[model samples]
Target: MIFQPTYLDLLLSGDLKKRAADFQRRLKACDLCPRDCGVNRVEGEIGFCGVGNQVWVNSYGLHFGEEDPLRGWQGSGTIFFSGCNLSCLYCQNAEISQKVSGSEISVEVLANVMLELENRGAHNINLVSPTHVIAQIIKAIYIAAQRGLKLPIVYNTGGYDSIHTLKMLDGIIDIYMPDMKYSEPEISGRLSGVPDYPSVNQIAVKEMFRQVGNLVMSTQGIAERGLLVRHLVLPGGLAGSKTVLEFIAKEISRNTYLNIMDQYRPAYLAGRHSEINRRITSDEYQVVVKEALRLGLNRLDKC
Candidate 1:
């Protein structure tokens, strides 16, 4: 059976075009993410993300560093967006994410990039840090789908998305890959500059799971569709992994594809904060891994 991405239905019904226009219109008083900066991006007013109406791409290519199902034999088609909504102190890709460093490209060009990745035989269209530019992506998808973009769309985000935006993206995005950064407001506030991260992240995760439940894969171990959650273990257990695991087990689902990442390192402005200014210990990583196991999350990603 040939897999047809959901965007095909939306594109055929003309809903994709309408959604693109509606979302682009939202940039006039932009409320794309949870921050609700409300800056007129179309008219060049900047907000928390530091990006305007135009879509910016730092880089786009086939990335092999992703999880098993996503990477597969052919790498995941990754489009790394420039700006980010959350202000994480220890951002690994601060050069692009923090500074919003990227070339301004039109929707047509972005659409072309998707087609190019497809031509190169990418498994999925992985949009990393896509919380801000969903409107542009939708517009590009609208264009690309008509030209035969059949790969599943991956919404890779920092987990600070709004419920309204998620509702709009319900059918467009096939795989929802978001980070569950923290479960404590104080810790989140100190580390990520978003005090409501824990609250906002949980709501966004629920919406993601609602749209696409547990991950479904092909016989070749390629991810077809679903929700894949990523939790980065911060130094000294600051991420509140227990509460996060508990929430996933109790609220989301036991069958959820959990990726408990241990690749936290001091980068960008992390040196200023002594607490998280170093790499996490081996014991720290295992503690969260053990908690996830104890919570009955059996489908943990072997990352």
Candidate 2:
């Protein structure tokens, strides 16, 4: 089946532009993420994410390191947005997320980047760490769609999202790839600096699933639309992988495309915490994977 991007329909209906404008207006108060920073980003007021009106892009290119469905044969077109709403203590991409290293560009240039990635034969436009920059991204998508950018958009988030902002993105985004960081609020707060992560993340995931149901793939195995959940297996069960898996199986969907990642290593300030000071053991990874399977989550990513 030929897959058309959801944003194209919104663009035709003129809702895309309206939504873009509303999202742009949000930058004034900047309640884009769960942070509710309320800083006037339009007037160059830096919020928790440290970004203003202009979109700051760390890098843009085809990335094959993503999930199989997203990467496919052509690779997923990734735009790594600098700065993040949640500060994960063990974040591997600390240079970009925490320090916010990138060049600021106009919405037109951001749109052009999307077009360039599509021209390079990317399966989808994956916006990495996008929760804080929703307004900027929405405006860029509006411009990109006007300039003939038709690739499926992937909202690759850290899961600490605002339902209001996500409601604005209902039909605009195609694939919703979010990380289910922790099932415990205390663990999340201690590790990611977000005390309300569990509740916020769960709500965001449910909203994402409501927008786009289960994973839909093309004959060539590229994701067209879906909610793909990622849970990095942390050392000493700090991630609460079992409970998270159960939630996915019960609340989300038993067939949810889950990536039980084993790539957790002590990066950033992880060494400060004894429990998360080292890489996850092979046994630890297996335990989580076993629980996921036990929960009847069949669509586990073969990584």
Candidate 3:
């Protein structure tokens, strides 16, 4: 790889190891995400995310369904961590996220998965739903970096992250692909079970942009580093898509790489909320995209 991942520098300087150890220690109380579930994860006590000390992985493989830059010809290496900080009413991946259906594995196995994906020619290691397991992921990254894992680490999240956790990952993660789910706190509360999602997500997204700036791609069109935001348009304007786009364009960056997703279908508990129990129309999708462009956010990803 021409573009070396930033974690290697940390690994060489021994900071990666230190961070890993620090994260491991935090498991005693486990305040990693915004939920602040102070359960003793090290003692196998499940918290709000239904996660314990060990890393729970549902699956791992090359995923082409990601944004174009992240998924090139080789595909993005996705390690689907099975648990989440938020319980979205319309959760698309409810089977895994809500139920927490995955096997608990050691950090060594997670590191091996990273190395295996790297050897398989994956362009990047994508950590799906990783907010709850940041400490374990960092520990695994430290291990994998020592074992010749060179691909950029993609921190794919739902944007309900804590500032403390994001601050700890300043130089470790390369690509920060986070979802700006909602702008209205009430909508977020009703749909996602997080009343403060708007405030928390906005702050987390801004921090992600600050950490990595705009998306950068290699000559081969594969993402090397930086922040990529995804905003899924919900039916009937429930997601407050316009205000969410406005935040990205104004508060974050006009040059920010954004994906205005339209593939929102009623899934999981979405049927309960009648307003969001249908797919978004083409007009609904296009209007948000046009508004984003009008706001001068031209770096749109055709996902």
Most accurate candidate by lDDT: 1
Write the residue-wise lDDT of candidate 2 on 50-94 in tens digits. Answer: 888887899999999998998999899999999999889899899
RMSD of 1: 0.8
TM-score, candidate 2, is 0.98
lDDT of each: 0.93, 0.91, 0.90
Model 1 has a clash total of 0
* Candidates' RMSD to native: 0.8, 0.8, 1.1
Model 3 is weakest, by summed lDDT over 10 consecutive residues, at 294-303
Query: What's the distance in Å from true for residue 156, model 2?
Result: 0.4
| Per-model TM against the reference | 0.99, 0.98, 0.98
RMSD of 2: 0.8
Tens digit per residue, CA lDDT, model 3, 100-178:
7778899999999999999998999999999999999999999989889999999999999999889899999999999
- Supply candidate 2's per-residue lDDT for 97: 95
Off by over 4 Å in 1: none
lDDT of 2: 0.91
Find the 10 residues in a row with the least total lDDT in model 1: 1-10
TM-score of 1: 0.99
Expressed as tens digits, the lDDT of each residue in 64-92 for candidate 1 is 99999999999999999999998999999
